[model samples]
Structure formats: structure tokens, C-alpha cells
Target: MSSDALLHTPLHALHLELGARMVPFAGYSMPVQYPKGLMAEHLHVRAAAGLFDVSHMGQLRLEGPDAAAAFETLVPVDVLGLGLDKQRYGLLLLENGGILDDLMFVNRGEHLFVIVNGACKVADTAHIQARIGQRCAVVPIPEHGLLALQGPKAVDALARVVPGVDKLVFMTGAAFDWNGAALYITRSGYTGEDGFEISVPGPWAESLARALLAQPEVLPIGLGARNSLRLEAGLCLYGNDIDTTTTPVEAGLNWALQKVRRTGGARAGGFAGADKVLAQLDGGAPVQRKRVGLVALERVPVREHTALQSTDGQAIGEVTSGLLAPSVDKPIAMAYVRTEFAAPGTRLNAIVRGKPVPMEVVTMPFTPPRYHRG
Candidate 1:
């Protein structure tokens, strides 16, 4: 897309003011880095706190009496039992047992608050409306701006601006007043850090961003660092690691599918692709491939779409996300290979530019997640 046609976030001007290099991402002109560069920004987030403008992501509300039940019909999650102020990750599935998109939904007492990927928001919103519009109100809140404050000190930085935010544990949220404007703050983030994602009115976005940046420990981070952070954390990127063709089971996201929504439970088998998904879950239809983490034995930076093969040279799978991890200081990747080759310590080769880069299947989250559960 052309630069002139790109949408801008509420903090666009602030990004430029901070010497950010803007790039096109998900149809928006977003900051990819700043004067400090991607490496520094990424390290800063791991050491301190970094504020990110994620307003391009979709925010919506599902309200009405049948919201939970109606929503349960679309995704394989235990939404009907979601506790007030608690959040859970879920996938929007296709009829063929594929993932339409992965999203985070929160039960906010009176309604359900949903946050979807920036690129998939339109399709997701439309799908939700078409399926359950009659049972509930599918109201997209484009007027709200989302910000993520992440790192070890994120709580300290955010609590200074929005008091009582420190009380929130991971996956929990509450409504708070920031400068008299209503704010919904959740203790959740994508970077595997102890952090908070704040939903603020669009008009107050810039003011809140500036306030957060005012903290001595906080710096404005951009998309470049955001991507690397999520990669190191073993989180899936919407289009790269997961998409319409991938199933939740194949992506190793089975833990997110609560047992209550699985076969033989009270709410079993009502979601899209339930039959196919449940079949795989129960071993009635075993998956041919499975997602696994790989650590390169060589220094080569294996990347997405890089083909994988067994030590003797038979095709196995392909890399979905990879990079020379900053924290681990090693080349790491995530891939889906034949289920037989998905075990830890299994040796494989990543074919990069016709040369073989030896890699071993290992566990994910190259770095341990630092979520504040208390």
C-alpha cells in the first residue's frame, strides 16, 4: 500500500517527534524503530519498561444476555464460564478445523471485551456480526486506542500513572479513571513480560502515552522491537506462525482450549470445526504434523518459510518464525514438522539458501515468560 493511503495511529505525531522510522504495517503507518534502533529498544524492554502504541489492533464489545452462549458457538473456548474481569486467549476457527485468527477476550461483568489482530479485525468483526448479531450487539470500538507497557518494571511505571493497576494479576483487568477519563487496564502483554495493556479513549491516548513516557524507566518502543520480543517469547505472529490454514492443535495451542470445551464436557463440540478439532483432540483423527521449537546448531539465522528436512534429507516441515534471538544469543525458530520428528533433541536441517543448517527440536519460549500471576 502507498504511504499516502496508510492510516495513522493517535500517537503518530509523537512517534515522529521521537525520531521514529515509520513503516507500513497492517494498513497503518506505524513506527518500526526509533533513534535508539531495534536492538537497543528490544534490550530496553527486557531490562526496564517500554511503551508501545498498539491502537491499530481491534477493540470491540459483545453485549446482551446471550453473548457468552452465542460466542461459544463460534470459538472453542469456555466463554460461558469466563469469570468477571478475567481474560482468556481463543481462536476463531474455520469449518475445516483451521484458525481464522487468534484473539484475547475478557469478561467485563456487563459485557465481553475482545481484542483482535489489526489485520484480521475487519474479517473477524464481520464474521462475529454475521453469526451472532441477532443474539448480541457486536460493537467495534475504533474510537479507543490501545497501549502496551511491558517489561519487568512495567507495573511500577504504569501504576504511577494509573493508581491501583498494580493490583491486577496476569489475565485480569478492571476499569479505572485516568485523569477523569474512563480506562480499561489489563495486566497482559505479548512480550512475555510482566506488563499491562491499557485501553483508553482515542482523545486521551496521546495524553496517556505522554504520561507513561514521562516515567524515567519507560521508553517509546516501536514495531521492530515488538516483533523480535514476541518472537523470543515463542508467541505466534498472526500471518506468519498461524493463519487461516493452521489449526489450533497443530499450532500447539491446545492448552488455551479449556477442557470444558473439549469432548465429553458439558459444552463439548458446538464451535466451528468442532467435529474435526475434537476428533484430532481425542486421537480419532491424529495430526500428521505438530509445531515445535528449533535451536540452530550453527550461527545461521534461520527464517520463516525455510524448508526443513531430516538428517538424511527427506522433507519434514518448514520454519514459521525464526531469528538470532537477542536474549538467548542463539538462532532459534518455530516450525511444524512430521509428528515423528517433533520430539526434543531430534536433529533436523533448515535448508537456507541450498545449504543445510543443523538444528535440534527443543522447547519454546527461548526465554521464560515473566508474567505477574499474583
Candidate 2:
């Protein structure tokens, strides 16, 4: 796509002012890095607080008496049982059980709010409208800008500007008034660190970003760091890791499936692709592959699409997300392998360049999560 065709975020000008290297992502020209570079920005967020402009993500609202029930038709999560101010991860699937997009749905008393991948938002909105428009109003809040402030010190920094956020536990959110604008704040983020995702009107985006940056503990972070941080946290990127051809079970996201949506629950098999999903749940061997964590026994960093081969030289699977995990100081990757090789401590080789690098299947979250569960 041409640069002119790409969209700009509300904080585009601010990104330039900070000398950010802008790159095209999800149809938007976004910041990939800043003057501090990826390593420093990544480490800064691990120590202090870093602010990210996540405005490119889509924020939508479903409103009506049947909002939750109507919305549950597209995803495999228990949206109908979601309580007020709580959020849950969900997957929108096709009839064949392939994932369309992964999203987060928040229960807001009278409405259901959702955040979907930016590249898929247009189609997602259309799908929701066509499927459930009669039962609920699908409203896209395009006028809002989203910001994520993350790290060990994020709470202290944000507490100086916004009160009551400290009381929010992980996956919980609430509406608040901050600096004369209405803000929807969630105690969640892509990075495993404790943080808050603040949604504010686009007109106030720059002002709010500047205010947060003014905090001694907060610095402006760019997308480059965001990617590495999430990679270390073992989180999946929508297009690369989980996509139209992947199922939740194949992607190691079985935890997102609530028991209420399973075979014995009150409203079992009600969502899209329930047959295939339930079959996988029942251990019917519908999935031939499984996603697992891989740690390089060598120092070489293997990247995406790198082929995986068994110790005996037979092809197994391929890497979906790989990085030189900054926190771990060793190469780490997430891959899909034949189910037989998905167990922890299973040995495999990745073809990096032209040579093979040994790797072992291991548990993910290469780094421990620091979410505020209190």
C-alpha cells in the first residue's frame, strides 16, 4: 500500500516530535522506535513506566437488552456470563473453527465493549452488523484514542494523574473523569507488566499523552519495544501467530474457552464453530498440531517462519513468533509442532540461515507476568 493511503493515529505528530521511526502497520503509519532505540525502550518498560499509543486498535460497543447474548454468537467465550467491569479474551471463528480475530470483550453494565485487531476491524464490524444488528447496536468508537502505560512503576506514575485506577485489579475496567474528559481505563495491556489501557477522546489524545509523559517515571515508548515486550510475554500477534487458518486449540489458547461454553455447561456449543471446538475439547484428535514454547539451546536467534525439524531430520512444524528474548538473554520462540513433539523438554532443530540450531520445548511467558491481581 502507498504511504498516502495509510491512516494516521491521533498521536502522529507527537511521535514525529519525539524523533520516532515511523513504519506502516495494520494500515496506519505508526512509530516503530524512538531515539532511545528498542533495547533501551524495552528495558525501560521493565524497570520504569513506558507509554504507548495503541490508538490503531479498534474499540467498539454493543448496546441493547440482548447485547451480550447476541454478541456471543461469533466468539467461543462466555460473554453471556460476563459480569460488570470485567474483561475476557475471545476468538471470533469461522464455521470451520479457524480463527478470524482475537479480541477482548468488556462488560459495561448495559453494553458490551470490545477491542479487535486494527486490520480486521472493518470486516469484524460488518460481520457483527450483518449477523446481530437486529438484536444489538454495533457502534464503533473511532473518535477515541487508546494509550497503554506499562511497567513495574506504572501504577505509581498513573496514580499521580488519575485516582481510583489503583483499585482496579487485572482484567477490570471502569469509566473515569480525567482532566475534563471522560476516560475508560482498563487494568490490562499486551505486555505482561502491570499497566493500564486508557481510552480517551481523539481531541484529547495529545494532551493526555503529554501529561503522562511528564511523569518522572513515564517515558514514551514505540512499537518496536511493544512487539519485543509482548513476544517475551508469550502473547500472540493476530496475523502472524493466530489467523484465519488457525484454531484456538491449535494456538495453545484453550484457557480462553470458559467451561460454560464447553459440552456440559448450561449453554454449550452455542457459538460459531462449536462442533469443531467441542470435538477438540473432547480429545477427538481434531488437532494434529499444537503451539508450544521453544528455547534455543544455542545463542542464535531464530525468527518467524523458520522451519522446525525433528532430531531424526523429519519436518515437524515452523516458527510463528521468535525473538532474542531481551529479558531471558537467550533466543526464544513460539512454534506449531506435530502434537507428539509438543511436550516440554522435547528436542527439535530450527533451520536458521542454512544450519540447524537446537531448541527445546518449554513453558511460555519466558518472563513471569506482573499483572496486578489484587
Q: What would the per-residue lDDT of candidate 2 be over residues 235-289, giving only the tens digit for each residue? A: 9999888998888899989899888888585687788888888898789856899
Candidate 1: residue 319 lDDT (0-100): 97
The alpha-carbon deviation from the true structure for residue 51 of candidate 1, after best TM-score superposition, in angstroms, is 0.5
- For residues 1-374, what per-residue lDDT tens digits would candidate 1 score against the true structure? 99999999999999989999999998999999999989999999999999999999999999998999999998999999999999999999989989988999999988999999999999999999999999999999999999999999999998889999999999999999988889999999999899999999999999999999999999999998898899889999999889888888888999988888995856988999999888888888989999899999999999999999999999999999898888888999999999999999999999999999999999888899999998
- Top model number, lDDT: 1
* Predicted structure 1: clash tally: 0
Judged by whole-model lDDT over C-alpha atoms, candidate 1 comes out at 0.94
What are the C-alpha RMSDs, in order, of all predicted structures?
0.8, 0.9
Query: Which sections of candidate 2 miss by over 4 Å?
Result: none
TM-score of each: 0.99, 0.98
